[model samples]
Target chain A: MTNETETEQTPEHVPMMQQILDNPFLLLFLGVTIPTVLYILWGVMEVASIPLAD
Target chain B: MTAETVVGVGRRAAAADFRTCPYTGLKVDAAAQTLIKANAVAAVVFLLIGGLMGLLVALTRWPAVHLLPADWFYLVLTGHGANVLLFWIIFFEIAVLYFASAVLLNCRLPAPKFAWLGFALMVVGAIITNVVVLQGESSVMFTSYPPMMAKPNFYLGLILFAVGALIGCAIFFATLAIAKQERTYEGSIPLVTFGALTAAIIAVFTIASGAIILIPTWLWSLGLIGEIDPLMYKVVWWAMGHSSQQINVSAHVSIWYMVGALLLGAKPLSEKVSRTAFFLYILFLQLASAHHLLAEPGLTASWKIVNTSYMMYLAVLGSMIHGLTVPGSIEAAQRKNGYDKGVFEWLRKAPWGNPAFAGMFLSLVMFGFIGGISGVVLGTEQLNVLMHNTIYVPGHFHGTVVTGTTLAFMAGTYLVLPLIFQREIVWPKLAKIQPYLFGIGAAGISLFMMGAGTLGVARRHWDITFSDAELSFAHSAGAFLMMGLNGVFAILAALGGAIYVLVVVGTVLFGKKITAGHKLTFPLHAGGGAAVSQYGSHATTKLPGTIVLVAIFFVCFVLYYFINWKYLSELWLFR
Candidate 1:
């Protein structure tokens, strides 16, 4: 809740968790980037470095 | 002044192309509504085609039946995998994404024309792929591994489909921004919308992966390149192929929560906990793609262990959280309604008659017990070695994708008709029983297929009998019996699917209109979500029933894991 709605009396108050939750862009960025690094990028690196079969 | 009355598009309904739902009071936009309807209708049409193809494939796999010829079997199997797994599911998901952002948030959809273009591209792409598969030249199966090349159009179809999906994800994100900037709802988005956000984020990653691999493969198919490395294609393709399962989970989990919320007035046991789980859910599910590559010698031991074994469990844990919380919240709400006699009274008194509840619960249970637990075993590098090419692999995915994800979507449609389409559902009796019929049948298909696979039935063979070969060998009698049972279950599941299509399509076409003050055919729980529906008190609600259910799940998981290891040891010891 914000002063616009102003349910709580705490001035300019929004929990850090609430702020993060409200930010869809930030969530999308982290969600896409994290998985890419851990899964796709990591797997690509390994595949790129695969030595020729003996 | 109630939270429920703060409509999304209805906020500015005087000027915009928005209408308020007579039942739920959410502001619905005409553009969003049309998009949702088109995508959903397309999804169902694909489902009908794909499901029939699956039935043919299953009958062909059953030696006693062997419905299709070898070439036709491979062709239908290819179409089945792509249609049901890719097209049907993604189309429905795009609909959900639109609904969650635009309707739930009470915001207008941005760039409606572009969204239509995206949908057209997807439909066109799906048609092209299906046409190519039907042409008898490109039966590479769903994975489409290299050297076994398909026509360039096949890969091109998939790439276009991926691009369309990416656009859909973008529209969802854009809708979210419009909602926030315009101040549709206060504080954080609803938990259902948050879950949708998780799914769309994953969709982007999954589609991007498809683009990365499929574009090159498309060129190779055209002879623009000499060849694609088998190992490289295998690894990257699994990223595109297997990781899409995560998209299904994320989307269907959103559906579960949405269904639970709408039908049963169920809220999560802990909002923060469940959202955290969704965060962990998508993050780790991508890592679980490593299981597909576990058998590849080119990938090392340490890589498989860290990614497949350790990190994959995080995905399992996320699902486990959802599995527990969904029912826990439901139980809490049920008990709140004065069904609080004992541990199981809430469970016993649930709306088992409602297709939505029944389907959602069945999906959650099947996904967790049969799908998730077995997945844990198969995702292990050592266990994967035993199960990799066996029919058990199909069995496991059948459990997840079919019973888990597909059933969830099927159940959600019961509600989708009235809410989105604003039409009454016909055939109340059939609607009541469709979930059980489909669920039991599909679960049987998964379990029996797994049973045969465990006995070392080959996964990728049109003929296990080898009737044409010079030398004929036979699997154990038990393997044959399990497959025979699989055929039977496929028939039952197909029956249920037909009923679903009839009821949904029939209702939308001819059922009574849901105008303002219309009597809703299937009654919703009166009032808003069981917002404060926690048991005991708000702080430390005790979910005794859910806790007991989860304990049983853990016991089953541990027992199954050890059993696989013991089975592995027996092979070596006996030989």
Candidate 2:
């Protein structure tokens, strides 16, 4: 519980994963964005794989 | 922050004041409790309706009974799916979201009026859909795949429901904000709440996908638009359908954690790892919606493989982590309580007599061994061909949804009765036996369905016997027997479900009221002191018993997964 706004401060070490986990909003962004990209890619690949009709 | 200074001293909202629960010493907001009560009661009503519809569907599938005619069978099946899969689960999950956010956090809910509006819309939508289904104009089945369009009201009803649920999710997020801004509690939220948050996040995406697909489909149904491509419908539709089930997984898993802490004062062996697993779910869980698309053409193998495996099954890795940690936490708790004699003593000495514990434990085993293993098999692109559109599909979900998620919900309902509803369980003796009755019957339904499926039982077909066909087709004797057994199991499961409804409704209606001074149904309840310190440094706690159980699970998973491949290979080999 180090103070960041104070003039003299002692910072605590936090792991990157813990930082992400601690912030639900960050995790929410990744959760939604990642899946949306994957889904679009899946749809795009399917459309691309289709042969042009004669 | 003393929960008074950072937050207003009192009267945030007209209904925002909190009363501390006598059992747990947690502050319960009046508005939030009312909403929880409303949503939970609605969930039970829908469960009764859906469970009965399921019984009818099962009986019709049984071949021996063949209860309903074709039209009615499809109608009831759709109702069963909509009511149980969508309505019952989502309504309860709304209650869960509120409970997890406000009740668990000891904060006042921000918008009680909006929450009620959401609950009202859900109820209205569910009723509208059920009415539409029963009117015999909409038998499009649960999938309601495009081109086989139902009445426009059916789609309309579903849209209303999704909108309502989305509102519920909004209220939940807002409540979380209020908690944070008010400084209700310090540090990270509890694991149970984290798990609920995961469910809520996925739920938003799922309901949005539903809105995207259903709104257009509804317009199409009304002749207001052009044709909907079947393939496109399947893709977007399962984004909603499959992801909705993912919400269930997250919610029920949260309940499992809550129950563990409540019952045994259990703490997770590794909070970091468990939270990481939930994070993995958020990232990759919805991508597994591709499992349904595996059998469809025009989708490339790369797309199929990448998505269905959830990017190397990272989502599955999430579930596996939960599977280990939930019970491991309980084991660790038991050890702390001096049940450390051997590998099995913790499990052995745990309260099996407690319906909540028994049902949750059964749900864990069945979900992992049967549901988890079967799901991976079904998810495999190559192997899915063997079981695609077969009874095996339903079999797999029954393992997960019914035996796993639904059973977990029922188990948690016991706690809800004692804690939230403030009622002692009626027929305490019957309550004790309910979990086993339900668990075994559900396990039977899953197994028998899979057996019948392996012998090539069609999923949505009206009759397996083909009595009126031009060329009379016959399933093997074993398949016939398995369907018969499925019917038997359905009755058993119905009895189990009936017992639940009877006891719960009876308890809610007629049971003695708890005034907090009285002992709870579980006299030994730890009163939630365990939740305060839910994480441990001991990620590597020795649990040889759990190791052996996990080994057996891995073995079963490997064996069953390959056997499907073996069956698939048999299909291609030319003699």
Candidate 3:
């Protein structure tokens, strides 16, 4: 069978994304990245995250 | 010719019987071959030089041995660092650029003359800077931190080299544009080309940042401008330096995909997934560069925290996604095709015996597990103090740069050599062993040095201790042991490099000359049609003596390090 049909048929698997809610490895990676992401998000939410001062 | 004749001519030209195998697209004119050969030679020379420098640094850090003289130590260190890290890897990238655009995409480089000009300028620039550093005119490390100045020529050479690289990138994009306008490929670019194109795009931005910083710095050096801001220059420099590094990372990852596809016939697990990973690099790589400045005094707490923590996390996510996708694709391919039923079926069924496949595999594993882990930890804000400018930094990069990027390039060379040169390798056995020796050695050294760095070992020094401070004898002993082990690895790598040189040289000079139409086959295999499928087509009979000479020059570079060490030992001894 051609690659196109196989790709179309295969179901999506978001194992990491799913596991991020629970799995230790996933959580550890997420725990580190999430806080940083949120911190950046917090600043961006206030204004653009540029310049030294708020 | 009539319009009909013109159409017919176009079709025939398109269908021209080039002797390159279907996989590698190595078929090209002598002129193109000359350009590619020149780039490859420069790349290999830089790779060996870089790898040797890496080994020396590792030796000093790992076993805490003072392998060279105290006075000239930092100068050699900086030269070694810049030559190998920036020069070697990027030269290979240029070679890759030539291959991807001209050969792989089946399009002539839009301006071959400009490309040659770029290459010439880079060579001249690199040589000047390298020579200046060797003479102890400057030892600013690879970063070339200003305030701690070098000769004016050093900065000028750096700017010229970067400008030349910019021209090469411009050529790459122009070629791509022409290919698109001319409708070179049937549909979307083949996966490899697509990946390379992404790398090229990243390179455009990366080089721009480099130029922005380096050009200003050069002017400042000449006193053409007064008072350049060191902080601002550093920030901008990282924009280039970090992004250029990302280009390597992105290209290496793409090569992982290619290696998987070509060697194991593995398809990307999810095409969209892989593409997304490449895209994430474009988004996150530049931002992540801020992590390099985490421990610096001037940067605000908020700035450092956000850049190191937040930006780095996103970068890590991109890397993690890729870490999953590359192997996933290979696994999916192996499983889908019904390879074997062992517990570790994928591993068991994999063509582990094939040097190209094995080398690619080891490179991927090393980069992902070792390099990836170190990257995350070092990028963390608190962890930066422990690792920054320490032996760990070099250790971490060696895992990625030498073992990861260089190994993939070597594997690609092995697969493409016959198609490019139309000659069988002189020593396939030794050729296969080279990557393993190099990769294992690199990993050992990186691991050992990282351990040393954790114990607070400084980098770019002839001694482990700070002046007037008592040294940790136990830590120093561990560092020495690692360095001694690294020396062994270096010797192995050199041996592997020797075999590669011999193979290329023998193939070019004395191997039985075969014509373009000759069917290529692996000596050991016959009926499987697998080996033949990969290499049998696109054989061309051509004298590659010049190419072989270029290869020899690179080999000699590795030899030079050892010879230099012999003399350098008289000045300073590890013992």
In terms of lDDT, the best-performing candidate is 2
Query: Residue by residue across A1-54, what tens digits does model 3's lDDT show?
Result: 699999887865655532332122232243334432433333233333235655
RMSD of each: 3.1, 3.0, 12.5
TM-score of only chain B in every candidate structure: 0.96, 0.96, 0.82
Tens-digit lDDT string for candidate 2 (B52-159): 999999999988789999989999999999999999999999999988888887788888899888888899999999999999979999999978989999999999
Better of 1 and 2 by lDDT: 2
- The digit string of per-residue lDDT tens for model 1 on B1-575 reads 11222344234434448887765667788899999999999999999999999999999998899998999999999999999999999999999899888887767888999999899999999999999999988999999988899999999999888899889999999988777667676556777888888888888878988998899999999889887988777777777788788889988898888787776667667777888888786567777888988888777788788888788888788988888788887887787778888789999988899898899999999999999988999998878877888999999999999999999999889888998888999999999999999999999999999999999899879998888889988899999999999999999999999999999899989988787788776777764333311111122376788889989998999999999999889775753
User: lDDT, candidate 1, residue B16?
Assistant: 49
State TM-scores per candidate. Answer: 0.95, 0.95, 0.77
lDDT of 2 at B327: 87
| DockQ of every candidate structure | 0.47, 0.45, 0.04
Q: Distance from true position, residue A50, model 2, in Å? A: 3.5
Order by TM-score, highest first: 2, 1, 3
Q: How many backbone clashes does candidate 2 have?
A: 0
Alpha-carbon lDDT, every model: 0.84, 0.85, 0.62
